[model samples]
Target: MAYEIMFASFTFFSIMRYLITRFTIPDAVQHKWRWYNVWISWIHALCAGLGCIYCVSIEPTLLNNLQDYDIRFAYNLIEMSTGYFWYDAIDVGVLSGSSLKESLILLCHHFVVILCFTVVVVTGDHVPIAIVCLLVEINSIFLHARQIFRMAKIYDGPFYTVNKIFNIITFFMFRFVSLSWMLRRVILDRSELSIGYFILLVTSFPLMIVINFGLFLQVLAKDVPAFTVLQKLQGSKNQNRKEKDACETLNGHMNGTHQTKPVMKAEVVSKLE
Candidate 1:
């Protein structure tokens, strides 16, 4: 059943990728590849997010017995996500033009997730914990939608702002609050957990916290007024530096010194443009 679900998930994502590429024209040529990727991601987030909710709704007891409870449907959902991560890791790392840095970060994340999920599927233990971790996907739906909106050039306006609001709210609720609660539970239940589960939780939770916190900061910098003010100040500083360099270059040209090096534009400017 796990194998069947994994295969079905891989095939479904593959079809989504093909259909998106064949039918949709990206708003910008540069967004062509990311456009396909983000749409597929949005679909996966929706499925996994809602699937987690339904699984928990039907099996609320799983939360009470996190160690030993097993739900076939929950395992199927984990398998489904495992398959999607495998597909996305391949798509981002090998098939897409993602930079080495971006690819490595995502690949590392996928590798950890696949490893953890594979253990649960193989051992048939910790299914409930897996589902709890997957609740973060609920936040990811908004995260991916934000990317979709950006790629489609829908930045300003009520809809985009509303999505951003939801993104921040969900990030706090699902990603931050849920993980913190899970971490507390894990520490409290350490004696009951197996050595393997203990090690996995100890290692994976910290890594996840680091990654999620980084993402949270990025979201805040983009959406929060305080961070936006800091960003504007940083931009102003970069602009002043550029102007200073230009003036120095002009002075060198006028004096026939030929010593002033050309100023390289700030990388932030290139990314924004």
Candidate 2:
């Protein structure tokens, strides 16, 4: 119940943040590469999160159905032991994996978790994981805030001005509040040590780092057009400068010739008169 309530509140804030972002950024920037990366990410997140929820609901039968309890238990231990930790780490990973393949990836994760739980099913110990997920969701809101302000500053469109800074600051506050709350819990006890444990124990963090890098790659791709335009403008300025220099050189040469030929022109005019 604590997890659900906390997560619910976080989700509500995320929804509002999305709305703020959608309004703040220009349609161009919002629909561009960064936007698409986030879109796919959220889609995958929703799918995986929902599937995990489903697995949670049916956890009772999962152990009974397993052919080998020990194997199932091992899988469950590895999966659950490092679950939340892996997700965050992978979010910042070097690989984009597949923007379009979010659903499939999440399904696999859900299956893996179910298999892990079957190995050693403890009926009542789910509360801690649930709370962790809630806190993680809240912390993720911070990730979005930076991009929102960065894009707004670049585009100067929509609510891209002063009021938007308040929204950004608010996002920071929410993140600190939620993250500090989770950190406090973890700091005081061994039971709440999943995040720290996973950080030390899992490869998921590297994967998430890759994903963040990939997202920036996408953003760079979107900026390519603007970059190209700037390059063209620069080239045009250089070309104009070259033409002006050539014209000035030609005029100067003609002026010099006229000055040198003046004596002969005057002599010819006197002879004609």
Candidate 3:
């Protein structure tokens, strides 16, 4: 029932988002369809993320006892989060029009999240893992904000600079901190969790971290050196082409002179006469 409601809510939110962006912000819609989707999804992720964090923190889930977290609220929260992941996997892939490889990565990510969390929901155990996974959303908030700014054409402004800084900081903080905590939990408390659940939790957690780290490196590579190395490479190519064109022009002129030299004096003399 929780899953059904959350799924319906996400579906409704997507439809309403499309309508509002299409009608209300027609300009952005016309120009940045992908951005429009990002903006709406960002809102959804933020809300769901905050709800998970609040539920996890307040509930005695993370209060030094993993097996003691059999609360219904946390279960419902994870279920909702799984629905949101389902929505994101489909929506982002369809809307972003990303490359096949990129789309697959995201879809696989969503698949893992939904599958693992669904297991936890069913067993009423490993709720802590679901909560930790949602911590990535803390970083998502700023990351999505940065993407929104870029799509809105505000990337060159001061606000974007601040947003980018926060994005990076939050990314490192949440990703590293969450990963470390999970690792510690796995190392010290392995006896408590079942082998199957432990395997799923361990595998899914590191997979997300690896994927996120790869994406972070891509961002650094594309955005940082793009302004410097790519520009310089382009300039050098243009310069070399110009030099080649100049040489070709000189050679053409010399050939023309040689062909015309024998007849030019007689032609000019006849015309003068």
| Leading candidate by lDDT | 1
Tens-digit lDDT track for model 2 on 185-273?
43455343345453431333233334434544444343346655776799999999999967876787878743447658978999999
**lDDT tens per residue, model 1, 130-235:** 8988999999999999988877777779988998999999999888788777877888888878888788887888888889899998888877889989988999
- Our model 2 lands, by Cα RMSD against the true structure, at 19.3
- The residue pairs in collision within model 3 are none
Look at candidate 2 and tell me the lDDT of residue 214. 58
Worst 10 residues of 2 by lDDT: 63-72
TM-score for candidate 3, please give it: 0.71
Poorly placed runs, candidate 3 (over 4 Å): 24-33, 56-63, 70-72, 92-99, 221-273
Best candidate, TM-score: 1
CA lDDT, every prediction?
Answer: 0.85, 0.42, 0.73
Worst 10 residues of 3 by lDDT: 23-32
Off by over 4 Å in 2: 1-33, 42-154, 161-163, 191-273
**Residue lDDT tens for model 3, 63-147:** 4565656667767777767767777777777767677686788788888888888887667777776776677787788888877
For candidate 1, the TM-score is 0.81
Give candidate 1 misplaced runs (Cα > 4 Å): 230-273
**How displaced is residue 234 in candidate 1, in Å?**
8.2
Q: Could you give the candidate ranking by lDDT, starting with the highest?
A: 1, 3, 2
Error of 3 at 41 (Å): 2.4
Deviation of model 3 at 47, angstroms: 0.7
